[model samples]
Target: MTPPTPAIVTQSAVRPLPRWALLLLCIAYVVPGFVGRDPWKSADVTAFGYMLELAQQRTPWLAPLLGGMAPETEGLLPYWLGAWAIQITPSWLLSPEMAVRVPFAALLVITLMATWYGVYYLARSPGAQPVAFAFGGEANPPDYARAIADGALLALIACLGLAQLSHEVTSYLVQLSCTALLFFAVAAMPHRTVAPAIALVVGMLGLTLAGAPALATLLGVGSVVLVVLAPGSSTDRRLPWTLALAAITVVAALVAWKLDLWRWRIVGANSGGKEWQSLARLLLWFGWPAWPLALWTLWRWRKQIFSRQGHRHLLLPLWFSAVSIAATLTTQPADRALLLGLPALAALAAFALPTLRRSVGALIDWFTLLFFTVSALAIWVIWIAMQTGVPAKPAANVAKLAPGFVPQFSALALVVALAATAGWCVLVWWRASRDRAPIWKSLVLPAGGAALGWVLLMTLWLPLLDYARSYGPQVRAVQAVLGADPGCVQTVGLSRAQVAALQYHGNLTLERAGLQDECNWLVADMESWPASERMVNAARWERMAVVPRPTDKNDHLLVFRRAAR
Candidate 1:
């Protein structure tokens, strides 16, 4: 009753890629953003702020409080991990914020490794393997699977969304890593003996603690349903995954209960027209090349995907992607929510490889090569403009965008950019001239190019990005206005990010502005001036100055001084 698999691959089609090349690709993707940057605005600094606070023992670890307000995300483990990393880090080595990045960077690496192994295991399944040739010359199972796994990792690295968030020291990073681990565990369940069981329970529990209890539950339920409904597998073989799911459910409940992460955060209707449009854009660009291929896999493998057979190779990833898509629909900033699905998406994308024609692969290669070559050239040109001002336009754009920025030259940044460019050229040359036709060949350039762009940004444009994204300048400007030893600041209408910055960067104690609280200086956002005055009393406060982040003109930081009696 099961539909026959469409794959008809041969030995030549799935040659093993070099292991060293894969290692280099992963390093290129993982290492750049971890070093040499301040925590950029919004979530990055906000999360780092909480971690720094915990490291300083400023608040209870269970409920991290910043400027008398808890972080908006309802998760403790991520903050706890970052705080622990800070504590463990030797003071002689790096700043607490940078120290926290080390552990999360490891989590990113783990996510990549887990995704690779997951796809590898899934590809080893009987249905997933290519058809054996009549003369015994079909692609060797191990080599084919390894090649496909290689493609999956490349697909994951090539995704535009993975670069920034994967490097972040945040709860959601932990959530994403857990999702990848779940992918591995699910794929490895039938193949492995003990490791998959442990990974499943741990991954589910980790996801629950990392501010995504709903997503964790959905994943767990989906896995359970697939295993139960799968037609071919006997109950004995399915028992382990079922038990694993049940264990995940129980542990996840405990995590949600203990951590207080369970809350109704689904905002408004599931989606409106505007929301759908935003999501469409996110899906189109965020998943990029992977989305198109995943669609291809779903369409081309429809019989295998939907058939009653225990076609878990297709079913598992589809289930994961479907659940994540549903989760994305219901969440705000759907892109972040959609990030959880990417590892699965990448795996789905890899399956499209065996089915793709020679023409299609070459087309992909041509597009990737041209797109990334142009992109790398643009970054180099902008860097030159910023430094030497030969073109004048990029410099003008930089100045116009980030006011008060003084461009400083770094030989090391320049050297790294040059090396990345050189590596890109070599890669392109090899791809063009070489006669090799590995299944992962088309994706190699795309992943390498994505990594190249990120490394270039991190190295060459880090200062500009830091100035534009960081709250340091605004905080310092406020500090100057407040003067040395200015005492506690009473604040109103400030975002969590601003409050965190003031506490960490300015090193000033903050009191939430109110009618009863008395403080020498008050800081507030301009829009809330009337309410701030009403709360802290209009008669006692005098306006000092308005400070804005260099790039954003609309958002103003207002400072006030209290009058003497």
Candidate 2:
């Protein structure tokens, strides 16, 4: 006998979150980080560099490179997308930096949409439906499913980790979006055929091209098994679809192999106690409220989860989440690996809403209110300190941390920040005073608060963050040292990001140190100097300046003026 579902909900509890509000929240979350920012640090800039290379026709499209080096992660599709965006966009409309981010922002939006639909379809499953009432006042299936899907979308936005990583122009975001598409495709299988089939193909192929061939293969294989064994699906009927999917999976793997994208990256065995502890900490904070809710969902829906007759609602998300968790444990970049699982985890979290007690919901609301309120307050206080220096400590701390940074006040930024803060206030009021009983009410504060903080940071703190995080300052310093027309500079031991920064910010022609070139200046990395020093004739070069990144004291670039000859 199938165990009874724990959800006991009336029509009132299934009240829909307003479409306008939901769309507004999504817009606020998706637009900020992508709009006005420099590509920060190792991953963002390195990826942008390849895109720029491709855009300028400086590197081969099939095999993108930066300063004669291939990308660290063998993903080609993201770079291609970015390059296409850059090439197609008019300079008057958007800068190359902003242009490259356009597609990625769309991907994040796609991830959100796919997650919502995935949860909606999963909730519509017969096993996942709320228990029917004898008196016949139960929530309508469509209404209940919509409410749950809204809650899942809110849960995804509420995840602390998604704000930053999803905004970056990297393969991870592509992989994440593709993963969500795959989740939706699988969940929507029983209802829709054409859309699901197209989604499956795109998702599998996207993952394979986005430096995650192994993950693509694993997810595809698992999904094929699920299709075959799905309780409601007949094996005979599903066989053709299963065979097609399996063949696509094999083709994806073969495509990866042909493109030379397969690389063995399993590094979990090397982790010690500290690494495990760090990963545990990451899980606790990164997944945030969603992780706890997912646990609750498993407990509440245990019977459905472990049923002999497979429950697609419980099993599909569980499989996706399990695979993501496994990848997180085994992969080199655990956070990016884990990002792929968030949509599934959010779906699981949404189901917990139907079973949550009023007290538990209240507790969640209160916690989110407190956490985000304090965080927003801190951001405002810091911005004030930066502008007026009324609070001396925060300003002093900023100066101490980011040496040589000049704080500039922007009226536009202030207006945007104030407006976002005011919107948050309105949202809080609507949640506390006007609205109650909606299943997604518990998550309103969390999602709103998250969007509030992100918008505030992107507006008020964007300049400071850009200075501290971006390599432009360092590159400018290097350029100042080089002066006008420092032609054909030779570079030794600079990382891909550093090279890209020089290329983009300084607009300098760079050649490798060993390359046959008549170059007047050579730049080298502080850390790589010792290894490369033996190859260069120290007598032939005079050290000019050690230009250091303002935020990092140890990261220095050594500029050398070739000895006058």
Tell me the whole-model lDDT of each prediction, alpha carbons only: 0.86, 0.91
- Per residue, candidate 2 scores C-alpha lDDT tens digits across 1-565 of 8789999888999999999999999999999999878889989999999999999999999988899999999989999999999999999999999999999999999999999999999888888889899998889999999999999999999999899999999999999999999999888987788888888998999999999999999899988988887766666668877887899899999999999999999885454689888899989999887999999999999998888878888888899999999999988799999999999999999999999998999899889989999999999999999989869999999999988888888898899899999998988888788567888899889989989999999999999999998999999999999998998898889999999999999999999886345788999999888445445776788998998998998899999998886
Deviation (Å) of 70 in candidate 1: 1.7
Quick one: RMSD of model 2? Answer: 1.3
* Cα lDDT, model 2, residue 300: 97
Worst 10-residue stretch by lDDT in candidate 1? 267-276
Q: What's the lDDT for residue 70 in model 2?
A: 96
Q: Write the residue-wise lDDT of candidate 1 on 94-172 in tens digits.
A: 8888889898999999999999999998898877887767788778889888989999999999999899988888888
**Top-TM-score candidate index:** 2
Query: Model 1, which residues run further than 4 Å from truth?
Result: 229-235, 269-272, 516-518, 532-534
